[model samples]
Target: MDISRRDFFKVAGSTVIGAAAYSIAGGFGSALAQAPVVGSTQITNGIQSVGSKAKVYFTKHIDAAHLIKLYDLINEGIYGKVAIKLHTGEKNGPNIIPRDMAKAFWQHVPNSSIVETNTLYKGDRYTTEGHKETLKVNGWTFCPVDIMDEYGNVMLPVRGGRHFKEMSLGKNIVNYDAMVVLTHFKGHAMGGYGGSMKNIAIGCADAKIGKKMVHGVPLDKELDEAWDVVYKQDMLMETMAESAKATIDYFGKHIVFLNVMRRMSVDCDCAGTSAAEPTIPDIGILASTDILAIDQASVDLVYASPHNKDLVERIESRHGLHQLAAMHDLKMGNDKYELISID
Candidate 1:
């Protein structure tokens, strides 16, 4: 999806106008409204699954019922090309979504892209081949990377990057009609938690872009660095939220956020170790079309969990950052992101 700066303007212009029209005619703009709104009725009425007491599945409990419920909400066409943006862990990591798990997860949404994106660091994942090799050896198979296809057009100009100077994306994603983001909900070393927002920035960016965002700056002026730890902390919160906003600006309704809160770890999946036992066990599954609301509720769950409460608050305080606060300030979505809880 590398377009010339001139073409970038064109994409922006047409996208803005079309988005406006979509908002006016389809109420798509209502989602970005600052005011909190709740749907007393089911916006998911025609979408609810046939059977099941569970509206959202539980820990490692992703069963047929769960898939059916999720599928009912997203399957507009009998067989459509869907993209499941995943988090393939680091070389030393044991947390990459298991292929068996991923296969089972996408069974309901069959014919998916199993779309793996590039990382943003120089450590191990500098190239797509590296990413592909790591994933394949680790049991990722449903969808593989095309060596001939350069998804991240870092070589050219990215369309509309709020903070990013340019972003190279694959043509597949730019043309993707529908996407189901499967995120592993866990606390990041840099941020309080890596949820829907980080999934887009870190999960979607190419190695070059990803590393820049991660190592951009460290906070603390007194520490000799111009940016404070807290400042850098807030920067990521800002960057992640803004990147998420940009993604929505182009493809809002087409995206759905699904956060898996099992194995609630203190570090990001990139850490590449067997994740620690949950401080507060039993983090459940959450489903929401609203990116903002789902993150808010998931963070609350982690903070409320005993093992995580200390780390969560400590990190937020130490860094002067909170994902929800940053996302709220950006108006990513309203504070009233209603929770359709599943027992």
Candidate 2:
């Protein structure tokens, strides 16, 4: 039987309550605390302290070599059929993480595969076959690239979420015991900035059903009209946070995050070759076991740079900071983080 989104939620209701209660019992916070902080430095630049801070490692050098070095710092819990979740980008997308860098990083991780999901909008990667071809065109051929939703979808409980009780993800997601979220930090059309959260929230969901839920499109509505629907920006951001929480909850302590701040445009890689040219100089690569901390640190770095005007404008205009706030409210990770530089 093809289960509808509403039906999936209905069937998973009891499990959702149990998961939410577990989250309330400090599961998320406790899991976050398991990652030991390597070192700390004095906080600066008016970035306020809130509770205990997570550690975000930064290196100004952006290259394949540094990526592998960064990954080793926080690779403790990532194991067993690891999924390297990253945006492979659209066909010939200029601003994506360089394929050489990705290939090198993939080689560093034992038993890993590059993972992605089909796009909600029509494009070269809108279908499984097309997505495969696009992957080759983008030079992602050196490793196994899993299109997670190629078969079907599965519902995962969303803990501590106001917008969702459960989220639909690619069914094959369960095959992985751990995840490494490698993101290309950049401007996004709707969520302000696309970070680790945006990468998994939109990237992990099943193309048709899960994406419609995240975008607040009624399941009965035509999928082709997704862009035409009117939805609150904050609501969309909150839903994204909720979706990300589901993935984090499912993986528990077995996930890590890294964001590459090179070639950042005021547009997402989904814009393909048409993305606005980046004016902000390349920042660095940031890695952490903390998703919120990594993204928060990335945003802080951008704000600290003098060339941040355009990207900042794009993020603020779309209410993108709300994504971080929502994740904080969900107890996904600490917004306050100690930035440790390895330059």
Candidate 3:
């Protein structure tokens, strides 16, 4: 049950009073109390989706003009240099955003760069050169990660994100006048589904920092003495959460979050070798300035689908993924936000 922002406080106050009244005089009054109102906006952050434009589009019939959707919120001079962060897929993975999509999206923006960094795990994806070679072999030679023409420049660096006092590739990304993040919305083995936060946070950070982001602390503090597979998972979660915070801090306010829910995958593009079909049907696209709101909406839709309940169940059972709970705890973003609908 969800309530709109305007009615949240009223509902909350009434809820408290009703609970007390029930304790004093239990009866129909309790039953009559606010029955978890459906669609009651609960997350009380500055992000009220009210009066804001959601701007939902899809590629069901017509291929979406994603950049035009961006143009809706963007105004001239609002930004000069824009950084386009996307997943170029992992070692053996496919379904990295299609090259055609890249050509279409990157071509639209002015002074934009196609950006990606390395990974922490010792693999072929560890170095820029190795990653580049992987992309070419994977049929990504046409659309490269860092390609600079007269209009825009793309780059990758050694260290990135807020975790470090100074990123080796510092200021180049941070110094950007404006940022636009394009994420292929999909489920993640780690964080349930890699939404805007995961896409930008881990995806934007260079390989060194990306590794740090995935190495979360052990879930069991006692496990410190026991660093096995159990400990590894915990550390990765911490990395996702910690590195996620960096992604949010750096780009949350300055960037726009966009997703193409078509051809959703259970794992991120990084899982290059294995292929898992999307658990659910395509839901189209969503764009938002508020990262949390968009993610919340994304989760809402995912959890709503009967085919995808496994994710929700797994998240709840394993790491409390219903809302990517750690994100709020780590202060990357909140689950509650104001979702204003635009055309």
Candidate 4:
């Protein structure tokens, strides 16, 4: 069912369940326990104590150097085998982050691999073979690109979630010691805005089981028929948040976020060549250790732009802002943040 803008905002603002106190089972749980605690109000480097607001770093320059600069600012906890979680994009999709920029940034990060999963929808990335070809066509051959779900899937506990008790993800995700969520901030057909949360939520899920969980499609449903089924928009957003929380809890303080807001389209990168042309002018890149803070900053920047009418309409029409509210009620991160200019 669809929700009106007024009713959606009221629901978003209302109190919901707090973060769950669940832990991963087996050895993964041990690693999670050692990971740095987040969601606290304490100030740290790259984060300020401006009324307990998280710090979100911004820069007008959208190049490799600037991207690396932003990454270094928040890279303190990122160590060991780093997984650069990013939307490698559909084949020949326009408005994706430039390959040159991503290549340069990838080279700068030591011991890192670009990580992705098969798409739920049937497309160029639906199969492992097809996904590899798409990666090549998209110019992602500069480094190791791991399709995390080529083999199988794994389940991660969804702490304090009303929708999902556990979320499914790529089993290979356990290999990474830290994750750098590199997102192309743009519009999504379903999630409103494809920010850091969407990048990890759907991007990390395996094609078969994990995706069905997020999309609320039955396992027996045919892939082509998945879109025909109707699901509540807010419930989808909350499920996305829950899936994101599973990933966040898995990595703990070992994860960081970066959102490249250059092509502000109302369509997701998954839309490929069929996606609508981006109307909003290019904005800067944003980085934060807090998942909620970086995405919230990106949305704020979009709304503040005078050319944001089209994008805003796309977001509002889809009730996309619920993403931020769901994340807030889940205590993933602070909605209030200090936007620090690094340029």
Estimate every model's Cα lDDT from 0 to 1.
0.53, 0.84, 0.50, 0.81
Tens digit of per-residue lDDT, candidate 1, span 141-231: 6654332124432222222333443333333455444567778887677676778777865565434333244335321112224234423
Regarding TM-score, does 3 or 4 come out ahead? Answer: 4
Question: Candidate 1: deviation at residue 172, Å?
Answer: 3.9
Residue-level lDDT for 42 in candidate 3? 34
TM-score of 2: 0.89
Per-model RMSD to reference: 8.7, 5.6, 14.7, 10.2
Point out where model 1 deviates above 4 Å: 1-68, 74-80, 145-151, 154-171, 210-231, 274-277, 310-321
Best candidate per lDDT, number?
2
lDDT of candidate 4 over 192-247, digit per residue (tens):
88999999999998777777777777776756786777357898898788888888
Model 1: lDDT equals 0.53
Error of 2 at 147 (Å): 0.4
Q: What is the C-alpha lDDT profile of model 2 across 177-249, one tens digit per residue?
A: 8899999999999889999999999999888677778887766564577557745899889889888888888
- TM-score for all models, in order of appearance: 0.70, 0.89, 0.65, 0.86
Q: Write the per-residue lDDT of candidate 3 for residues 211-270, one digit (tens) a residue.
A: 332443222322234344432444444445444454444433456667666667676677
Candidate scoring better on TM-score of 1 and 4: 4
Task: Judge candidate 3 at residue 207 and give its lDDT.
Answer: 43
- Candidate 1 TM-score versus the reference: 0.70
